[model samples]
Target: MKMKPLGRTGVMVSDLCLGTMTFGTQTSETGGHRQMDMALAAGINFVDAAEMYPVNPISKETVGRTEEILGNWNASNAARRGDYVLATKHSGAGFSHARDGAPISGQTIPQAIEGSLRRLQTDYIDLYQFHWPNRGSYMFRQNWDYDPSGGDRDEVVANMQECLEALQAQVEKGNIRAFGLSNESAWGTAQWVRLADETGAPRVASVQNEYSMLCRHFDTDMAELSAHEDVGLLAFSPLAAGFLTGKYQGGSVPEGSRMSLVPEMGGRKSDRVFDAVAAYLEIADKHGLDPVHMALSWCRSRPFMTSAIFGATDEAQLQRILDGKDLELSQDVLKEINLAHRAHPMPY
Candidate 1:
């Protein structure tokens, strides 16, 4: 439960951030409250949510319920609201439910922030992120045919400038303190950084991407940029959507789990994913370690990682992850993991 600086913001955040994507859907409001209480009591001071959360079903009705649940907690525990760092995102285009599928622009920035602040019951958001690049991203199983060539460079730069200016206005108005990115590539992040620098607006503070033992795309170019530019990574799905937790082994989809709720598991479900997960689970077992611990602790050990974002349906699952906050992977274990990655890289 140790704290780390979030980029160069002068703000300290817990190494383990409580992810609330399941707050109002798979997990009830009571269960969500219990999870938050346990995480805070156990010294976790960071919580991440989104405007389009409770995402197993991801319906319009339930889109912002997760933030609302957190907002209710903040309102009920006003004295403790300042004790934690609250982060949420503004959903980009393609979801007809959010802003009628409008791409993130100057108009949508204020519109999204107002709703998020209202639902979160907070005046200032600790971190406000673009859910994904409006142009598109290679994330969520889109890497195969991903192409940014179709986008207009002039239009994209114009949008970034306008959006960054709008975000700066929000900062001036005390609605949001920081800006970040999600599901972005190195090129996409670079454009944001360049625009921010040229405009004297807020530099991108962090990038929340899917980084797990099964996913290593961020290890190369993104790692280098983060190291030099101070845009730390808020790694989401450190467990690879519970695949690294060892619960989904043997092709068994446990009832009430994420896989059970969304069989495709947001495109992480594939024929090759299980074998990749098994290899890591074997390495964890060989080292007499819990797979969850090996997965989470390994993320913390990374040089440019600010925090590992993980969600839990209940307190037991949350405790299982928290117990490994201090566990460190031995060099031998790390070597084995790397060897396994080489054997079956990009399983999903």
Candidate 2:
């Protein structure tokens, strides 16, 4: 696997990042350990987790289980933890499970980091991210009626300055190496950058957002920010939560699948979703490609993409997705994908 620079953080991460949200939920500790070994063996040096994980049924009970699983692996294989770039997030807004839906503040930063460190059984996190902006975000299918009228700009910036200073203190304390943002907008990311730059704190290293063939919202403004500012994209749901994987192609949800657990696939199961999936699947077939491979490779092929965060419930699924790491898309296939995007834009 190839490595990419994580912004200006001086940390090189594998292009393919193993996402651990499924751990301790549909996947057990033993299963998660096996997946970790497989991912490491496959040269995936980056692992992504969150404080509120095991998210198929994200509950207070199973909240930090994913990080605990990674911590256990790190504890046992103490020597190998240093080889992987581990990234996790602080849940913000609407997640009553994490700090009772607390907006991320300077006060919450240390508490959240300490909780994550204990759960992961590690002293330092490679990349720590704000799961979403405290004010709010339009990433999760909220772009249709998205508005940023919640908080005053000065108040938001002051809050961010405080948070960034706290993060910088954590960096100085060697608790977290770098910082990132997720489910954030271009303007939101710019504010983070501006605050970090002005305050002499750590700049945002990456932004983990929903980016795939179906979701191209980041292609315009955020893409420009990423390219110029060196803030890479850690794209989550590059497969659109398996909608692009072609498993739910004909509206038949497979047993023991994520969709079976969360029937709506987190608001992705709309009437137009299958049409969009079919379009991509057809492009894959026309190009003599597996849809899953095509989907992952497409995400990896994007210029702004540093790592594609993917999760698997089983080793077989992990292997299938990993097989596409080296598969580069041809121009004709990309053209067809673009044409399909024009035909069925925003399927979900």
Candidate 3:
């Protein structure tokens, strides 16, 4: 429940961000509200959501339901509107259910913001993020077939500039306080930063990407960019979609778990992922630590981390993670974790 600066935006955020992706799907509206209250009471001030959320099985039916839930909470909690930093995303192209399969572009920015604001029932968003780059991204298990050759540099930069202009308009209108990116690469982030600095638009304040014990892609180039560029990492799936929690370590998919619902685990299902989990679990056991706490605490230990985003289906799970919010791994434990990473790099 510690606060950190969000890039160069001067916005302060909690070290742990409560993710509401399961709000309308696995979690009921009441449950989601309770979770938010608990998170705020625990000193967590950052909450992240998206337009296309509640994704155990993302359908057209539930496309904007997550935002609506938060909106409802906001309507009732009018007095505490400014208590937390609220963030959400506009889905990129190929999200067929939203905007009829529209890609993120300057043309869509205004409309997207209007829709999100209406659904969120709020006047402004603390941080607004692009769900993905129109030029495509290597995150979400797409790294294996990642082909960056298709994007024309000029076209991509132009798009970012256009989007920045639109974002600047929103900022002027008091619609959003800061801007961010998701599922983006170091190169994509660089372009956004360059355009922002050159044009004096709202600089990219954060990048929300998948980062966990098994996924170390950000450890090198992205880490350097974050450290020097002042762009903090809003690490989604910091627990590896729950794999780092050890619930799926032995192929035991409990009934309501993400694996049981989506069996594929978003392409995270692999023998190697379990092998990686085992290695980390070993470190946790050796140090007499809860694997879930160990994984989250490990993320908290990273200097470039703005927040580690996590989701929970129920209060119990949420509290378990909250219990570990302040747990810090010792130097010895971190050394062993680094060794584990070297032993099992990119298991999925």
The lDDT per prediction is 0.91, 0.91, 0.92
Q: TM-score per candidate, in order?
A: 0.98, 0.98, 0.99
Using TM-score as the measure, the top candidate is: 3
Q: How would you encode candidate 3's per-residue C-alpha lDDT over 1-348 as one tens digit per residue?
A: 688999988889999999999999999999999999999999999999999997998998998999999999999999898999999999988888888878788889999999999999999999999999898889989999999999678887888888999999999999999999999999899889988888899999999999988888889899999998999999999899999888886669899989989998989989988988999999999999999999998987798899999999999999998888888899999999999898898887
- Best candidate according to lDDT: 3
**Per-residue lDDT over 1-348 for candidate 2, one digit per residue giving the tens place of the 0 to 100 score:** 889999998999998999999999889999999999999998999999999998888888999999999999999999887989999999887889978888999999999999999999998999999999988889788888898888799999999998988998999999999999999999999999987888789999999999999888889999999999999999999889888888887768898888999997777788788888888888988888989899888889899999999989888999898787789889999898889999998887
The ten-residue window of minimal lDDT in model 3 covers: 151-160
Model 2 residue 110 CA deviation (Å) reads 0.6
Q: Which stretches of candidate 1 lie over 4 Å from their true place?
A: none
Q: What is the lDDT of residue 26 in candidate 3?
A: 96
Q: Please give the range of 10 consecutive residues that has the lowest summed lDDT in model 2.
A: 243-252
lDDT of 1 at 54: 88
The residue pairs found clashing in candidate 1 are none
